[model samples]
Target: MSLKAWAAKHYARRVVQSDARWMAQPHQTQEAVFKKLIRQAKNTAFGKDHDFASIKSPQDFRERVPVRDYEQLRNYVERIVAGEEDVLWPGRPKYFAKTSGTTSGSKFIPITSISMKEQVRASRRALLHYIHESGNTEFVNGKMIFLQGSPVLEKKGGIYYGRLSGISAHYLPAYLQTNRLPSWETNCIEDWETKVDAVVEETIRADMRVIAGIPSWVQMYFERLQSAGSKRVGDLFPNFSLFVYGGVNYEPYRAKFESLIGRSVDSVELFPASEGFFAFQNQQDDPGLLLLLDAGIYYEFIPADQFFDDNPPRLGLEEVVLGKDYALILSTNAGLWGYNIGDTVRFVSKDPYKVVVSGRIKHFISAFGEHVIAKEVEQAIQEGIQAFPARVNEFTVSPQTAPEEGELPYHEWLIEFDQEPEDLKGFAAEMDKSMQEQNSYYKDLIEGKILQPLKITTIQAGGFDAFMKSIGKLGGQNKVKRLANDRSTADPLSAFKTT
Candidate 1:
């Protein structure tokens, strides 16, 4: 091994050894971590308002602070943005990770120094754990490309604002900077088409071993690489071995991605958002991601079935049961107290808690009480594509309300295919069957004729890209919503349909 690879392996080994005991006692570790965070932030306005100084336990914390979404916390966030110190955290946050918003154009999530450290530590530990568990360190010897947003952050209200990936780029460890691909200048290119082309030119001939990004964008890069006369990604960079992806389910894109790479590579999934880095796939055999308990975030879970209740029970790590879907609530060192990040997850294991992200709380279709979620839609699409010779590039579903009386509302799916399916109607039927099998509510709706059969509209190959581009959300951390509760997203997507 090269000196850098040897150093990386050694460091990873040390982290694994140190974290093993804590991982075994996740509940206890989390309790202690939560207490420390409470104590640290007790003097802040939010803490004081929530009676944090007197809160002795998780239950106390929950009772004192109501669960909040981004909209509810916007006032305090605005204060911080307007140069108010100690409004949320100890002082002004070092940066704010910008994300799409419902009311506002964007939401700026504070990233304090402490929170940034936690994010970095969690990411490092995740990578190290993978290396330790897999016993593979050769990839560390070659360049690892992280396809991320622009590294050049926009300064707004005296704080840096950008996507989580861009914010993270500013704090990459010195060791990683040396082996990372794509120069800082290339990363600053704002246009997706232009930037991806530059990325291909810069990294095509390099000894790349690991590529990390959202699967859709990574697939785009791979296509561009192939279009530049490369037969496959492996042909251009034979050493490419690891693919780390998150932000969307990988099942639908797995086959297409493998075909582009020309071989199967080790893959890891991460559950990270603008709020925090929550979990990562630690073992190859395990499909669930191990929850990061000791990270600088205190977690609470509200059962998905009970989430709409006025005062649903918020369960701690010890209270969570296996195989139950829960909406994640977080109290972070970044000054977000009792915050609902809107993602739902299910605990697949309990001993050392491991979870699979189910879907987003808002990203569901319940127009006629079917309550179809992102997971279901993804799985159905995967099953649907199996009935034909094609692969799903991207897709979104929304309710198509009846235009006139007596017309039944139905789910409308706008799909962009990597290869056009031979039998589009058959594909739609398969998807309907899959959904009926997965969700009893959906089955009832279909059988009762309360809802019409799902309507599938096949879009041109790059329809999703065009839709995102039209909305100025074409790349870098902007994901196509898998399921929208309304026609707001679906209507615009329909405009991009292929002739």
Candidate 2:
């Protein structure tokens, strides 16, 4: 091993040890974070309004602060954006992570200094843990790339504002700076298609080892690389060994990625968002990501089934049950209190508090009283691929409430396949069967003839990309929604359907 690699491995050992201590005491660490957050922000406008001074326990917090989505919290956020001091966090946020909003246009999430530091620390520890467990620090010596938004920031109310990924770019550790690929100039290009082309040109010949990004955008980079050299990505960059990703479940895209790279590489999954750096994969063999109990965030969970209730039962770390899905709520040092980030997760293990992102709280279908989520669909697709080998590049599911003459309402699956199954009908049947098995409500609907078995609409190669490009959401933290309750996604995708 090179001197740098040896040093990294040595440092990784200490990081693992430090991480183990907090991981062993999940609830205690969370309580400390909770207390610290409440104490620090007690005097802020939000805290004061919520009577933080009187808060003494988790129950007190739940009673005082109602669970709020971004829409409900916009008034306070707007005040902060107008240069108000001590509005949210103490003083002002270091940056505002600009993200696409639903009812509100362009949401700005505050990234306080304390929160930013935790984000950086959690990401670094994820890598260090990998090195400690696998003892594979050789990748540190080679080129690394994180395909992300441009680093250019726009100033707003005296705070730097940009996408969370862009803000993160300015905070990359110095050690990785030398090894990071795709020159800064290329990264700053505003147009994603143009920027990706530039990235391909710059890193085509480099010894890339670690490539990190959301899977959909990274797939574009991989395709561009393959098209440029007519070689599998694994062959083009033989040293490429680790794939790090977050934002969306990667299982649906796994077959295509493996085919593109021509081999399976080790991967680290992260559960991070503009709201907070929540978790990271700590075990090489485990699918669950280690919940960051010691991070500057306190977590609460509402059982997914009860999330829509007017008064859902909010549970702390000690109250969460394994295997039950929960709508994740956050009370972070970043000044978010009882915040619903709209992600749902299931605790896979509680020994050290490990969770798997189950689906988005809002991303599901219940058109015919059959609630099907992203996880169920993704797993069903994976099951189909296992039963009948096919490579799916991209896919999305939505309820097709209206169909042609004599057709019943059903779920429509628009699939972009890199390699179509020899028996497409059988493949669809397998997926439908798997879905029925996973969700009993869906099974009841299917059996009762309220909904027909899901139908597949083949998308032409590059169809999804074209749709994304048309919508001006082609890259950089943008993800194709896996499940839509309505045809908002399905209709747009229909334009690219195969004849």
Candidate 3:
């Protein structure tokens, strides 16, 4: 091994040991984070307004602060944008991560210096843990690329603002900076197509290893690489061993990715957002992501079923039960208190606190009272693909409440396939059967004649990409909704539908 690789492995050992120590005391670590956050933000505008000074326990904090989404918390965020100090956190944030919000058009999530450090630390720990367990640090000597947004930022009110990925680009550790791919000028290109072309030209001949990004965007990059070089990704970059990804589940994209690469590659799944670095995959063999309890954020869970209740109970880390879905809430040192991020997760393990993101609270179908979630649909499709060999590139599920003349209402699945099954109708039937087995409500609706069996609408190759491009969200952490309660996304997809 090279000197650098040796040093990285040595550091990895220490990081893994340290993580084990804190993870053993999940509740205590969370309590420390909670107390620190409350004490530090006591004098802030939001803290003062919520009476944080008198808050003594988790219940007291919960009673004082209501769970709020981005729109509900905009008043305080607007103050911060207007250059107000101590409005949310202890002082003005170092940067604002700009993201597209559902109800609100754009959101500016504060990234305090402390929160920024925690993000970097958690990311580092995840990587070190991988190295420590696998004893593979040879990739450290080669190029590593994070297929990300532009590193460019817009400065306003003395704070830099950009997409979370772009902001993170500015903070690459000194060791990895030299090995990172895509020239600075190439990264600055505003248009995603132009940027990908530039990236392909720049990194085509480099010794690339360890690619990281959301699966969809990475798929685009891989396609570009394949088209430009006429070689499988594995052949083109033989050193590429680790594929790090987050933002969406990778199972649906796994077959397509393996086809593109011509082989299976080890991967690490992360649970990160502009709000905080929440969790990372600690074991390569495990699907569950290890939640970061000691990482400057206090977590709360509301039962997914009870989330719509007027006063859903906010359960602490210790109170969460295995296999039950919960809407994740966060109170961070970045000054977001009791913030509802909309994503729902299920506890897979409690021994060291690991979770699997189940779905989104708002992104589900209940038009016929079936209440089908993203996880169920994803699993159904995966099982279908497994039973009948096929490779899916992209897909989404939306209720088709109105059909022509004599047709009954049904769930419409719009899928873009890299390799379509020989018996498409049979594939759809298998998927429908899987969904019925998983969700009793969906099954009841189908049996009662309230809804027909799900139908598959094939999207032409590149149709999903075209749709996203048309919406100006083609790249940089943008994701097509896996489940839509309405036709907002489905209507636009009509143009891309294959006969």
Task: Give all candidates' CA lDDT scores.
Answer: 0.88, 0.92, 0.92
**Clash counts for the predictions, in order:** 0, 0, 0
Q: What is candidate 1's TM-score against the reference?
A: 0.96
Candidates sorted on TM-score, descending: 2, 3, 1
Model 3 ranges off by over 4 Å: none
Of the two candidates 1 and 2, the one with more favorable lDDT, higher being better, is 2
Model 2: lDDT of residue 139: 98
Compare candidates 1 and 2 on TM-score and give the better one: 2
TM-score of each prediction? 0.96, 0.99, 0.99
Can you list the residue pairs that collide in candidate 3?
A: none
Clashing pairs in 1: none
Q: Candidate 3 on 1-499: residue-level lDDT in tens?
A: 9999999999999989988988899899999989999999899999899999999899999889999999989999889878789998988999999999767588889999999999999888888989998999999999999988888999867899999999999989998989999888888888998888998999889999899999999999999999999999999999889999999999999999999999998899999999999999999999999999999999999999999988788999888999899999999989899999989999999988999999999999999888788889999999889988899989999999889879899999999999999999999999999999999999999999989999999999999999999999998889999999999888899899998
Over 4 Å off in model 1, which ranges? Answer: 387-389, 403-407
Instruction: Report the alpha-carbon TM-score of model 3 versus the true structure.
Output: 0.99
Question: Which model is ahead, 1 or 3, in terms of TM-score?
Answer: 3
lDDT of 1 by residue, 1-499 (tens): 7787678788888998888888888978999989998998898888888888899988788778899999999999988877888877798898999888888778999998888998888888888988888878999878999999988888878998898999888888887788897999999999999999999999888899999999999999999999895589888889988999999998889878888989899999998887889999988889899898888888999998889988799988888888778999998989998899999998998867899999999789888888788888988888987777577788899988764577888899998888768888898889899999999999998899888779888788788888889989888988898998888888888878877
